[model samples]
Target chain A: MDSVVFEGIGKRYRSLWALRGVDAAFRQGEVVMVIGPNGSGKTTLIKCLLGLVRPSEGTVRVNGQLVGSDPAYRQRIGYMPQISQFPPALTIGQLLEMMRDIRGLDAETVDDTLVGALGLDRQLEKRLSTLSGGTCQKVSAVLAFRSRPSILVMDEPTAGLDPLSARTVLDQAAALRSNGGTVLITSHLLEEVETLADRVAYIEDGRLRFLLPVKEILQRSGATRLAQALPVMLSNSATP
Target chain B: MTKVYKYTLVDLARNRFVLAFAVLMLVLAEGLFRIEGDAMKAMLSLVQVTLALVPLVTLVFTIVYSYDTQEFTQLLAVQPIRRSAILAGRLAAIATAVLMALAFGLGLPLLVHLPGMVSLLLFAANALLVLVFVALGTLLALTQRDKARGVGIGLVTWFLFVLVYDALLMALMFALSDRPIEPWVVPLAALNPIDLARIAVMLRVDLAAMMGYSGAVYQRFFGSAQGILLALGLMVLWAAWPALVAFRVFRRKDL
Candidate 1:
């Protein structure tokens, strides 16, 4: 199966360690929710995978190719950052055109299915800064999924999104996962995680604390649901 | 890479500040022409603006613009584009934008007035000014994160080049007045892009009239076609040096 392998990944910024000797894999055709508290190296891990931030130690491989050595590897993975900030003056149309141009794809060849679903056609003329947070998140969604990448790494995908738009975004991501694509999502919203994540990787203090299926997490915690089980698991892990 | 350049150029070319700059240049150049009634005199005034305002505007504008495009850079960074391409493309975009503004701004008025060589040399000098400053701005922006401090350094850089450096040269000239400082003055001045461009123009137009003894010294070394070629070559080197530095920083930078 296709997988992104993190082999003893370590990242250090001066004296502070962001990720330490961590080994993990985001395997294909599954929605893997990476859950962690704030500043738990979640963003750092994502950046390392994208090759935006170089790792202090170890290597990251996407489909067995080093992410750093291969720019083409990035084409297979679509990434959506936590914040959906773009150039303030740029219109959505212009941005999409630039993206399409950069991707070396023609209009007819490009798949902007998410754009149509989100009703972004009317808002295409609007400047980026004018959009509400939810709408901006939607634009980010389109950019991520429109390219039809095999893997999607979304950092806090629906943080500022409205319930309805968030549903659309989640549904689009889920659709991508069901179509033999791998998805890696990080979010504080456990309810969404429960609905979407097939397996959850609990990260804390720059290490993968626990990784288990949602059902197993619930069963082991002696709780009926993942929401209730998460606290129990956290307490047990802390004691251990 | 070409795609990045195309969009960056187009996007920046249509920016309001670029348009405003162009309009302001037209107004200033035309007004100077009307007031002085001599194209040569008007060009001298324009040269001062080019030396002072061009560097500051290009440096500050490029730095601020670089910070503004951070998000866009992120968007591109995740793509199949190389980091060097991303940095170089953006730098080229900004240089192209600023050059276009200066061209249209000054070109609208002075194109019809100045002699062909003088007009072309003037434009070349200004273009080099834009390239050099933008490259420096790129390096500064890559190294420094704080916008206020970055902008502050940019302002100080302008002040150093436009005012302080010249003042220091004047002091050096005074101290070594009897020591054949003539040789040192021109060589030292060549280090600054502004000084190099200023000499390039002064040699072409009126060197002896405006510059007194120092002018004669410069005219002797930089008076010939070979000297002019060398000066222009140095100006190109000035642009290339900072651009190379920025590219190196950009490649190693963590987004």
Candidate 2:
């Protein structure tokens, strides 16, 4: 079953159309990496799915329910925004406690694996403002995954992480995909997507250029690596 | 809503700026009381200071806090909560923090020195003023996307409320002093929370002679219990209108 669907989504900010007629669907268990250059509306597409940006047209469906109709559906979605914006005054521990309190999730149901994996447990007492950009990103990751969400939406999840931390995130995404959880991510790292994404969503100039499986992309372009295959595939697809 | 409010309050409690504001108020109030050596005189001095200072502080602080929490607001927006809860919670937390600062800084001084009905009314008036400005600040923050512009607008709003509005009203009154405009001008006070608060406390303080023409009219018109209630009701309306509009804007706004 399709766990998430965006039907002809369109978003306009003042004069610029950030997204126009974007349509796609993610299966119950798949990792789809959204690929686009800067200012290509990749984040806007993800925001529309998260209901952070209301689509000027069309609708988003999560678990077969309309996105804006109810917020309860978000309980199943774990989102890590590209920029970490937790309260600056809060310690990492306090922020975690606050999220748990907001969700009303008890101790037994809460997942703290990322807390240990991200090394956030040791730095729990550090205020968000005091943490470096990389550490803050890890905190965002821990919060995103801690809820044990069925549908995960991570926007450039590994943008600021070190290689080791980035690997842990990828492993977590892979583990979640294997457990039948859907993961939607956007990253500039095509190599990471090579091993992680089941499918690739290439968005450019505020439009979805293509949505194809990874194996098909490699096969169609006749390139072994995604880095070389994507350009060839886009040019080939653009021509025909 | 309570969850948002609780966490926001927790975040605010950790803020040193708010603590400094409280301390500043305490020092000012205590200083005035010590110099005057009389509770009533000290309160009169404090009233003038707060009339200008409280709104300015609340507006600036609220605007900065709202802008700083943009990321936090975005984070909460994707959660399983209504937009209204997020807005109301943050607004309530700002109000609570400012009110606590006022209560400790000013209210405690009043309770220690005056300890009477007039002082209590003064505290209530200050509290209402805080709410009104916080509402205005929230509206300003939500409307203006740029932080510098928002803070600039906030300062202008404080100026208009604390100084410009009264100046315009007084100028109009003096220009129209020949006509029977005093009665009509009484309602105009309701348009400004600062004016309403000033009139409300002045009446209780029994300062009709000091009250200008409009204030005298307010005293005469709303001198009774029903009149005081009516003024407070108007202040509450002032406190709520901007916040309600801000909430509506937030509902459809792209975070």
Using TM-score as the measure, which candidate wins? 2
* Candidate 2, position A193, lDDT: 59
lDDT of each: 0.83, 0.89
Per model, kept true contacts as a fraction are: 0.55, 0.74
Q: Which sections of candidate 2 miss by over 4 Å? A: A237-240
Complex DockQ, candidate 1: 0.61
- Per-candidate DockQ versus the true complex? 0.61, 0.77
Mark the regions of model 1 whose C-alpha exceeds 4 Å error after superposition. A106-109, A225-227, A238-240
| Cα lDDT of model 2 by residue, B1-255, tens digit | 999998899889878889999999999999999999777898998888987899889999999999998988999988888899889899999999999999999999999999998888888988988999899999999999999999998898888878999889989999999899976787788888888888888888888679677766877888887888888889899999999999988998888
Worst 10 residues of 1 chain B by lDDT: B205-214
Kindly list the per-residue Cα lDDT of model 1 for residues B101-188, writing each as its tens digit. Answer: 8988887677777757877878888888888899999889888988889989999988999999989988888888888777687778
Clashes of 2: 0
